[model samples]
Target: MSTTRPQLPDDRPEQGGSGVDDGAGPAAAVGRRTRRLTLVGASGVVPMARDFAREALREWGWTPAEGADRKAAAEDVLLVVSELVTNACLHAEGPEEVLVSTDGKTLRIEVSDLGSGEPAPRTPHRAGRPGGHGMFIVQRLSIDWGVLRVPGVPGKRVWAEVAAPA
Candidate 1:
């Protein structure tokens, strides 16, 4: 399955933590609180959603330290985001949403779609197929990932987390 990319909002402000700016001027002090970035109707918004999540994490206080530390973690997070979002768009019908947040120690990524079907890893024979590797990749890269059925929502939310690089 394939999908076209969604139009992202161009007016998003320079990222900040907790949706708030500290008194230390925009450049003075980095915010320490966890921040939430949400993308609604993510049917075709996979790429943009990944970018949004990365930017939100950077804005929330994560910075690349010396010697390939934060960059690797950032890449992993982006990859997982892409996999999860793409899976939602391809397997689910109707609108989709993505929620990203970080608790300093770990980053949380979640994608929700209108389709109630839960995702499962493909078998070894199916692994050679062109599609269906998204969920598998997510499972491999994330420390932990799973699906949750929300009471009021029409679909399940697939979520994953990776430890924040020190």
Candidate 2:
């Protein structure tokens, strides 16, 4: 739920489709795919969330069977998912939901929580630090990531994107 980059993605939908599946706009698959899981009040949320994301990746053809590179890519996505969910659990009371979406070229992972505190990477990162590496890891693994306030809502959504393997 934290990031050093904090680079905001374009505020527009992808292509001619909404490319979002949380009911934020008109529904349109159009070759895009999404999977969502509610973690609110759930026990053992971190591993549960990671498993959920792994299934989505495999279902979307990102797996060892795809090739070695694809397998590594899938692992990276799983790590990002774990870090974000864990951050929410630690900093935001707990995560409310996890939404994973792919548009053929990139995978987006979102973690939503009710906490109002903003997530920012610990600046001047120290290599020997013992903790607080979550956001730093996220920033390194992701192509772009940032926090978005949910309009008319009390919570915010932290999102990260990973490029598909070539």
Candidate 3:
């Protein structure tokens, strides 16, 4: 599959964890950046998702910082991306596009696919199972996440929002 990172709006603030202030502004109220990726198929979508997230994090200043928060944020982003993309690849035909956006305080991830079935976290919590923890992980890590059906469209968009590093 092909992965592409388009240029986001320049007005959005860049999220850097150094807290050294690169003159971007206060981290609390930083602007937003949204990156969209169009995937051709399921093959290698996991790595593609990770790469897309990594590039966005670097651009947003999620580099290694003094505190663990920065690292945690980066890891969370990667994990969330992997989980969501993997879910799409496994359950649906494949992901059509993945959108990752951040407003310094929170990171929002959305995976759109050509599937109508809604994704739900498995009930009863099968921790010992070979799999089925993807949505569970997404639920635990994200502040909020859910599936959205596009009006008059054939597919749905699964999305999650996680708090950025402190």
Q: Answer with 1 or 2, whichever has the higher TM-score.
A: 2
CA RMSD for every model? Answer: 9.4, 4.9, 9.0
Candidate 1 lDDT by residue in tens digits, 97-122: 56666646777776667786768777
Residue pairs with colliding backbones in model 3 are none
Give the better candidate number (2 or 3) by TM-score. Answer: 2
The sequence of per-residue lDDT tens digits that candidate 3 reaches over residues 1-166 is 1112222233242332321232335433446566777786446888988898788888788865448877887888799899999898889988878877777778888787888777878888789988889888888888878776646768877888888777
lDDT of each: 0.63, 0.79, 0.73
In Å, residue 69's CA in model 2 sits off its true spot by 2.1
The number of clashing residue pairs in model 3 is: 0
For residue 70, what is the lDDT in candidate 2? 81
lDDT of 2 by residue, 14-131 (tens): 2222222443332233555777788877899999999888888877888755778887789999999999999999999999888888887999898889988877778899979898
Candidate order, TM-score descending: 2, 3, 1
Question: Each prediction's TM-score against the native?
Answer: 0.70, 0.83, 0.79
The total number of steric clashes, by the backbone 3 Å criterion, in model 2 comes to: 0
What's the lDDT for residue 13 in model 1?
25
Weakest 10 consecutive residues of candidate 1 by summed lDDT: 2-11
